[model samples]
Target: MKNIARTLASLLALALTHAPSALAQASCSSDGTPQPVAIFERFISADCEACWSDAATPAPSATAGAAVLDWIVPGKAGDDAPLSAAATSDALARLQTLGRKPPVATDVHTAAIEATMPARLRVAHGMPFNDYLGTAIAFTPVQRAAQRTGAAPAAMDFYLLLVESVPAGTEGTKVARNMVRNMLHGTLDKRNKLSKSEQMKWMETRSMRIPEGAQAERLRMVGWVQDAQGRVIAAAQSTCR
Candidate 1:
């Protein structure tokens, strides 16, 4: 099993390029140069046993990913969050090039996320709520099945919550959704053995929601995922006022 996993990881490594440094992360929306969302990272050291305790590669690592960058995005605020295709594409492309462990340890870096974050962002999870200074997009989870019949999920489900309402004239809500979440969960390639990047990617993939044209005032949504039997997986929450 170990040999197979290593082989696969090597194969993946061969296909990937060196990851861009955290500095490569963008500071603004494509059109809006001002609106910036804060970035918190927790890259675990190679010697950190806590980092790998969760699994072969460890999803919820006990070791912390380093909190690297936090910058505010400057921009004009509109009511609804703008969905950017370019931003999404760039994010996906970056994920395809993972060469090493990122300075991100999921929940472990949330505290830094809130303190350093310039704008309100619905963080993925693990940071305390009181520390959050700005708007956040939190949500609960819902479940879906695989296209294959009798195909058990290779791994657990991922979820995001939209408890916080993103109102009009906010600094950078759209940037938060696109950059922060995608940065966390966009790299999701799976081999027999898993890595932290793959797990985070899975989380981002399944978790998210909008209240179906609901006005953005004190609005809240839950992003979560469940099993075939409707059992809860994991969830996060963020809201707007």
Candidate 2:
């Protein structure tokens, strides 16, 4: 059984390493920039107008080394909802993925990985064409100085988020927010049996639609990896040149 799993993982790794032109076109990346050590997610309901303007919104400090993402969830009011235009099904899906119910107003969750990262996780996007944007996320694990003895997990989950940077005072909000516009999810098999000369890496690429009213220039990509036990292992946010 272990050999079979390793065989499958090896095939997946080969596919990722030799990815086609789609990956070549993925121009924007977080490769050279410093990666964030934590993620701060905020979910707000469209029906609750006050939620957007809430004065108590949590804002991570610039020096905190965290990526903050805001998600506007669809509410019961449908089209009549105040922030309905900005709401997306992806938000609800994310909540479900986290095993949480929609908040009546707003909710915040934080996941912090390490003070000094041991893995490289990057997110990137290409130039937009036909209202679609090419995006990708990659992860490569590095041996820690003090290597642990346990075997690697069989798989890890990845999340690539496209968010619009909304400045403060734009919607009567006192704090700036990186509002999530779209998201891509993937699973990375870590069971590959690699030769000493081979590099073990996992990657996924996709085309994401740019939501209406979302400025392409303001869009940024954020990505994170979670182990099988749901512990975050790495996080990164893109910075366009």
Which structure among the candidates has the greatest TM-score?
2
lDDT of 1 at 189: 24
lDDT of 1: 0.26
Distance from true position, residue 16, model 1, in Å? 23
lDDT for each residue of candidate 1 in 29-97, tens digit (9 for 90 to 100):
111122112223223322232332333331223444322221112112212213321112222222333
In candidate 2, stretches whose alpha carbon ends up further than 4 angstroms from where it belongs are 1-26, 61-63, 114-117, 143-153, 190-199
lDDT of 2 by residue, 1-241 (tens): 5445444434432333345334444456686788786888999999998989987887765667788999999999988999999999999999998899988899988888853336777777766665666676777777552245234445788898988998998867878989999988878874332334434566776667788989988888898998877788888887776
lDDT of each: 0.26, 0.76
lDDT of 1 at 77: 27
| Worst 10 contiguous positions by lDDT, candidate 2 | 8-17
Q: Candidate 2: which pairs clash?
A: none
* Predicted model with the maximum lDDT: 2
